[model samples]
Target: MHPKKVQKLIYFVFCCLFTLPVLAQNRVVTGRVTDAKDNSPLIGVSVVAAGSATGTATDVSGNYRITVPASATSVVFTYIGYTRKQVTITGTTLNVTMDAAGTALNEVLVVGYGTVRKKDATGAVQKVNAADFVQGVTTNPLQQLQGKASGVTIATTSGDPNSSPTVRIRGTVSLSGNSDPLYVIDGVVGADIRSVSPNDIASFDVLKDASASAIYGSRAAGGVILVTTKTGKAGTPQITFDAYTAAESPLHLLDFADRTQYLQAYQQFYGKPMPAGTSTTSDQGANTNWFKLITHTGISHNESMGISGGNEKGHYRGSATITISKEMCAHLS
Candidate 1:
């Protein structure tokens, strides 16, 4: 070969020898971790290379960077409240979304004055969790529990916005006034359910029969309703907002006489047409609709915003909400 060609071939051979060693070494791995429900990043999640000591934790934004040997087959990602995830090392970057583990079977319920595990409680107590309750435009917390609990009956005496519903447990107790069950909120005995908003409640527990009511003695005669509010989870501070707007009208409107019918009725009763100019309003012309005049679409809204956070030791949550509704009157229009 020519001298220049020989030199060029020698240089190429040297470069290949140097790169071969690097290619056999460990590979760099990167990924991100997020929540499956909200897609929020999970920080400080443990990421470990399978069958190797190589490992790293995610940053505040759930991004992780690590290096693993060529022998590594997969990487494992884990968080406290989420299920573990394993991804094969097929590419340079992997993104994982983890779902919350099933923990409802281990949930704790607040009874009369104490608390007990849900599985251990033998009472007829039926629990309606935050997810099961009706969420929108509910002022009196009892409204959230309507028809959800067995043997519980909810009745509203009127459509007044400020009035709370009468929640009866196990029918009439003594044929007396307001046989509604007693409400206990956060351990406050005989609490008013109206004071708490459905949007703020975390759980609604109803204690029925003697087994469940034995905790409170005579006060439990009418049964009991226990309410628990939301609290922060162990993690970084997070802000959340939820809102709902609803409009409601009567299911059926009343059928009434129009102007012609009113005049006819007057003629039938008094043998005379409707007196001219007796009423200056449209009703005199029979064009006025009595039902429509008094009835309007009832509008209601529920809005809430909160911030919560904590570490392993303790956690707290604070929130504010607004609810608007008007009394539903008879729709004469």
Candidate 2:
């Protein structure tokens, strides 16, 4: 053969070798992607042939058709919020059923600036839902969180009902400055916790480490408390009412000496009869049970009402709460 003819023949063989694979990939594979739980068609699902760059997406009807090489044995299907699926190409028709992904692990959490999935959150975060709140009358919203979270301390500084509870996250950090964690309610920084009733709250997201300082700055040196309130949902009008009443009484009373016992004790100690008009005012003939006069039963009552409704365009929610508490010796003690 001539040398020029040989070069032409080699060039033709190389082109054929490259084109043969492309020509052999003409096998058509059709399939439908549907949710495994609901059997509903899933739209915008990605369909790709195994070990090949050829891919396509399912249409609105969740129907997909793709061309694959004859050697391709399996096809891959993927969709957002659904698990990835692989189907064997037994024949030309390849149907795929995808299961929902993430389950409870995909729950969304509200951070300082944005939201993150529960599994994706790297910081020390704890979430408390209203459903888990303590069942009973709560003088303050913070009281409901007592003993619910780890590495957190909630205590009342005094018995005063109006006093806010002392909240310490991961123990106290500051010696001079305020050690209380920063409170973020409904995206509002430094909002007073007293303004929000426990009945109106949906959840509490507590960032309990230095990671919180990165989001809220130095004030969050102690930690951060993110409060998410309840909002309206897309549904018919709904109204709710809640009310409760509680009574409190002193568990024990201190023992005190009567007039006769006091006189006898004073005589025994001083070796003399009690002097008249002494520090002992009982000498003036007044026998008063001060403890009995000062203390009484305390009563507390609370009521809450809320209404919510909306449509696809917008939603609205209104809520109100009333709390009345009268404690025994609240001012005298």
Winner by TM-score: 2
Considering every candidate listed, which one attains the maximal lDDT?
2
lDDT of 1 by residue, 1-333 (tens): 999999999999999999998897888888889999999999999999998888999999999999988888899988887788888988989998989887653677666657788889877778889888865566677788888888999887777667888777988896765576777888888887777656668888888877887878877888988888878889789898988888888888988887767778888999965676565455534576667767777888778888998999998888887877764555443
Q: Worst 10-residue stretch by lDDT in candidate 1?
A: 277-286
C-alpha lDDT of all candidate models, in order: 0.81, 0.85
Per-residue lDDT of 1-333 in model 2, one digit per residue for the tens? Answer: 999999999999999999998888679989888898889999999999888999999999899999987777899887778888888888888888899986654678767778788778878888899988777878788887888889989988776767899999988898999999899998999999999888888888888987644778898898998888888999989999999999988899877887878878989998988856667443454456778778899998889999998999998889889888887874663
User: TM-scores, in order shown?
Assistant: 0.57, 0.74
Show how many residue pairs clash in every candidate, following the order shown: 6, 0
* Candidate 2 whole-model C-alpha lDDT, 0 to 1: 0.85
Write down the TM-score for model 2: 0.74
